[model samples]
Target: MHKTLSSKQLIINEALRLGFSDIGFSTVEHLAENEIHLKEWLDNGFHAGMSYMENHFEKRINPALLVEGSTTVVSVLLNYKPKLEQSDPEAPKLARYAYGKDYHFVIKDKLQLLFDYIKSDIYPDLEGRMFTDSAPVLDRAWAVNSGLGWIGKNTNLIHKKLGSFVLIGELIINMEIEPDTPIKEACGGCTRCIDACPTKALIGPYQLDSNKCISYLTIEHREEIPEEFKGKFENWAFGCDICQEACPWNWKARPTSENEFQPHPDLLQMTNDQWHNLDEDRFTELFRKSAVKRTKYKGLKRNLDFLKKK
Candidate 1:
C-alpha cells in the first residue's frame, strides 16, 4: 500500500473513496468576472426575497476573504440522479434531488471526513472550511474555475460525463495546489431549457429570474403565490426540475449509488389524494430528514392548494 502520495492525488483519491463523483482544484482568487454578473443579477431584483444573496457580497466574489490563508479550492460533485421517481404521475411532483434525505446533511458529513483525512493523512497543519450550498460560496463559479464542468445555458454546471444532475460542494484549504482549466461551453444554441420553463423564468440563456422560478416560489417564497402564475406550476409542489429535465446534457445522467439519495418508498407511492390530505404529523413523519422539509407543512399545503384550485 502506498502510504504517501502527492497532496493533489491524495485529495482526489480520498474524495472518490468518500463517494464523490469527481473533484477538481483551483487556486483561491477573487472571482472578478462573476462579480459583475452577480451584481447585475442582484441589482435586477432577480434574487427575489432571498436577502441572503445580498449579504457577504465581498466574500462571495473572493473566497480568500471567506477563508483566510486559503490558497486552494477543491471542488467536488456528488450525483443525486434518482433511479426511481414518484409512481403516481398525478401526484404533485418533487425535484428528483429531494427524493430522499436532505443533501446538506449527507454531503457535509462526507466533506468532514475528507477534511479529517487531509489533516491526519496528508497535512497535519491544514485549516479550512467545507461548504455545500450552506454558505455564500459561489459554488458553480468555483466548480467552473476548477475545470470540473462548464456553466450550461441554464446556468448549471454541466460536467461532460456526469451531466447536470449533481450537487456541487467545496473544500477551501491553505495549501496551494496545481489548478485545473475551465472547460468550453457546449450548449451550442440549444434553447430547450429556456423554452421549457413554464413560467418563463429562464429569461435568457445563462440568466434566471427567481421571482418567476417554480423552485423559488415553492421552496423559498414566504408569501402567497401570485395568482397571475396560477396553473403554470405544472403540478410541482416542492422543488422543480423542468430546466434540468429539458436540457440535452441531462439525458446522459445516471442513477445515484448513494442510498441516502433514493426516494422513500412512501414518497414513491403517494397518490394525489394522499398528498392533498397530508396533515402536519404525516408531513413531519415523512420529511423528517428530507429536503422537502425546507418548505414546511404550511408551505407545502399552500402549493397543493394552488395546484388543486378550480
Candidate 2:
C-alpha cells in the first residue's frame, strides 16, 4: 500500500514538476523586521520614482491581509540562468532575466495553476492569490522568511544551490503547512557585490539606493540618464547584472532548464550597429513577450544612448 503524501510533500512535488528550482512554506505573519527596514528605506527616498512602494505599507508586510484567511505562504524560485551569451561582446548588454519571456507572466501562470490544483484536488475550498513582483508583496522578504534563501548583500535572494539568478513567486492560501526555518545571513565579510557596483548602488551590506542602481535607471527611471552617472553604466541597456555576476554564490550556478527563458537568436546576434539602428518594428518583434517590454522602445533607446555617451 502507498503511503499518503502530506500536503507539504504534495506541494513540493508539484512545484518541482512545474519547474520551480525550490519551494518553501511560511506561516502568514507580519514581517516586523522587514517593515522596519522598509520604513527606513522609504523615509530615505531610496525607492526613487517607484511611488507604488509606499502605497501599501500594511498589506506589504501582512500576508493575511492580501489573501483573506491565508495561513500559508508558499514561495517558489524559478531559475533564469542563461545558457548562452550575446555573440557580439561589445553589443549593448541585456540582463539575463529579460532574455526570454517576462517572468511576471511565466511565474504568475505557474502560481495560478498551483492554486487551482490545490483548490480542486487537495483542499476543495482553498482561496488564495498568486503574487509575483507585480504585486505589493515584498518577495525577497517572504522568500527569506520561507527559508528559500538569505537576502544577499546585493539584496537578491541567494539560494545555496541556485545562487540569485531566480525569480520568486508566492501563493498565499488558507491552509496550515509546515513552515521552513529562516536561513541565517551568510555574506560573512564578503563584499564582492558591493565593490563591483559601478555606481555605488549598494551603499552598505544589504542596502540599496535605487536612485543609483543601474537596473533602476535603465528600466524604471523615465527621464534622461543622470549626468552624474555618465561613463558609469558599463554599456548595460536593459538591466544590470554586475552585482550578481560578482557574487561568489553565483560561481556555481547552472543554466536554467526552461526553454522559454532561452535568449532569441536575433537577440544574441545583435551588434552595436543593430541595436543603434533598432527600429520600432524590430524592437516589437524581438521583445513582444519579454520583460524588456517594460522599458518600452523609447526607454531602451534612452538607455542605449546613455551607454553610447559613455
Where does candidate 2 stray beyond 4 Å?
1-5
lDDT of 1 by residue, 62-180 (tens): 98999999999999999999988888989999988898999999999999999999999888889999999999999999999999999987888999988999999999989777888
Best by lDDT: 1
**Model 2: how far is 59 from its true place, Å?**
0.3
Off by over 4 Å in 1: 1-5
Instruction: State residue 118's C-alpha deviation in candidate 2, in Å.
Output: 1.1
The alpha-carbon lDDT assigned to residue 223 of candidate 1 equals 98
Worst 10 residues of 2 by lDDT: 1-10
Worst 10 residues of 1 by lDDT: 1-10
Candidate 2 Cα deviation (angstroms), residue 47: 0.3
Structural similarity to truth (TM-score) of each candidate: 0.97, 0.97
Can you write out model 2's per-residue Cα lDDT over 184-221, one digit (the tens) per residue?
98889999999999999999998999999999999999
Candidate 1 vs. true structure, TM-score:
0.97
